[model samples]
Target chain A: AQSVTQLDSQVPVFEEAPVELRCNYSSSVSVYLFWYVQYPNQGLQLLLKYLSGSTLVKGINGFEAEFNKSQTSFHLRKPSVHISDTAEYFCAVQGSNYKLTFGKGTLLTVNP
Target chain B: GAGVSQSPSNKVTEKGKDVELRCDPISGHTALYWYRQSLGQGLEFLIYFQGNSAPDKSGLPSDRFSAERTGGSVSTLTIQRTQQEDSAVYLCASSLGGPSGGYTFGSGTRLTVV
Candidate 1:
């Protein structure tokens, strides 16, 4: 079974500041990792994913994440954040069984 | 549709009533998924459908929670005798089937069981 853990429940940042949302996963087998963002009442939007190859993955909206196999972590980072970046972020893992296990989520609150 | 579409953007129903939520995946996308988001508890996987094979229903919480995909395109999630616990944002997503491509999500149905 695969499980995901998002380190923070809420993160408050000033606009244009850099931020990182921590995520870690536990799985016995190789798995795929993903990061998604949810704004207000909207559904989740894929921010990025890590399937194979490079450890660092870049995603939409200037967001990026690094997949550290040894540490079992896939942390998301953004150089500069905007007020529009304030949203709920989630980390997910998909194992061979093909089921996506999501973390509780981290709410990003960017203030101007 | 250009993206996954979920009907009944918001639903308010009395406890014990049955409710049905619909999802239309993007055309040609073989994999469909259902998830529920509650207040503090994050998104919970409910079920998955891929092509003509059987669906992975291991995530279904209980017998009251059931879903069906017809002709391998549209899916309907039926919750029999809904409870307050069932009140949440039910999200639907579709993918190309596998790890190669991530999933595309719909706005979701906000179900409020009174």
Candidate 2:
């Protein structure tokens, strides 16, 4: 069984400031990691994923995440954020088969 | 190209009524998935459809929740005797059936059970 933990429930940052959303997972077997963003009333959009062969993954909107196997973490980062970047970010783990376990999301609130 | 599409963008139903939500995956995609998102919560996997095989129904909350895919393209999620707890944004996504391929999502159907 796999489970994801998002350490923060909400994060508020000023526009143009750097931010990191923390995510950690627990799994006994090798797993695939993903980050998804959801705007209000919209479905989840894939921000990035780590399948294999890369520890650092870059995604759309200048977002990136690092997959740290030893620490069981896949943390998302962005050097500068925009007000449009405010959304709910989710961390997901896909273990054995295609079933994905998602963490309680972290809401990013970027203020101008 | 058109992205994954879901019909009836919003639904308001009385308690104990049955509701059906529809999803149309992108062309040539073989894997389809259904998920639910409640207020201020993460997605909860509802079911999956891959080709002609039986769907992975493990995520359905109860017997009232059911889904079916036709012609390997369009899928429908039906909730029988809907309860207040069934109200949520039901999202649908499709992928290329690869371990690394990311999914394309639809706008989702916001079902409100009154």
Candidate 3:
């Protein structure tokens, strides 16, 4: 079985500032990682995914994540954020059975 | 028609009542999944249907939770004698059939047990 852990429950940052949402996972086998974002009262939208290849994966809305195999981490990062970037972000891991395990999520608040 | 669709968008049911949530997967999608998101919590997998294979019910919390997919296109999640803990947003998603293909999620049905 696979599991995901999001270190921070909430992150507050100023507009134009950078932010990083930490995520870690546990699995006995290789896994695929993904980041999804959800705005208020909306469904989740894929931010980016790390299936293989380059460790650094870029996603929509200027978001990117780096997959660190040794640390078992796939942290989402943004160079500069806007107020609209505020949302709840989820980290998910897909194991061999193709089941996705998700972390509790991190609430990002970008303020002006 | 183009994306996964779930309804009714919001459902309020009394305790001990039975509720059914519907999901219509995208045309030609071979994999469908059900997940529950509690308030301030992440998504919890409930079940998944792939092709004609047996549906994966391992993630179901208890016998009170059951689901079925019809004709490989639509799915329904039924909760019998719902409890307060059953209150959550039930999300439905569909994919081309693998982790690499990713998934398209519906807006979800908010089930509120009173």
What is the DockQ of the complex in model 1?
0.89
- Tens digit per residue, CA lDDT, model 3, A4-58: 9999999999999999999999999999999999999988888999999999999
- By DockQ, the better pick of 1 and 2 is 1
Q: For candidate 1, write residues B5-35 as lDDT tens digits.
A: 9999999999999999999999999999999
Candidate 3 scores an iRMS of 1.0
Candidate number that wins on lDDT, 1 or 3: 1
lDDT for residue A21 in candidate 2, whole number 0-100: 100
DockQ values, each candidate: 0.89, 0.71, 0.77
Candidate 1, residues A23-112, lDDT tens digits: the string is: 999999999999999999899999999999999999999999999999999999999999999999999999886778999999999999
Give the better candidate number (2 or 3) by lDDT: 3
Off by over 4 Å in 3: none
> What TM-score does chain A of each model score against the native chain A?
0.99, 0.99, 0.99
Kindly indicate the candidate among 2 and 3 with the higher DockQ: 3
Per-residue CA lDDT of candidate 2, range B5-96, in tens?
99899999999999999999999999999999887667889998988888999999999999999999999999999999999999999988
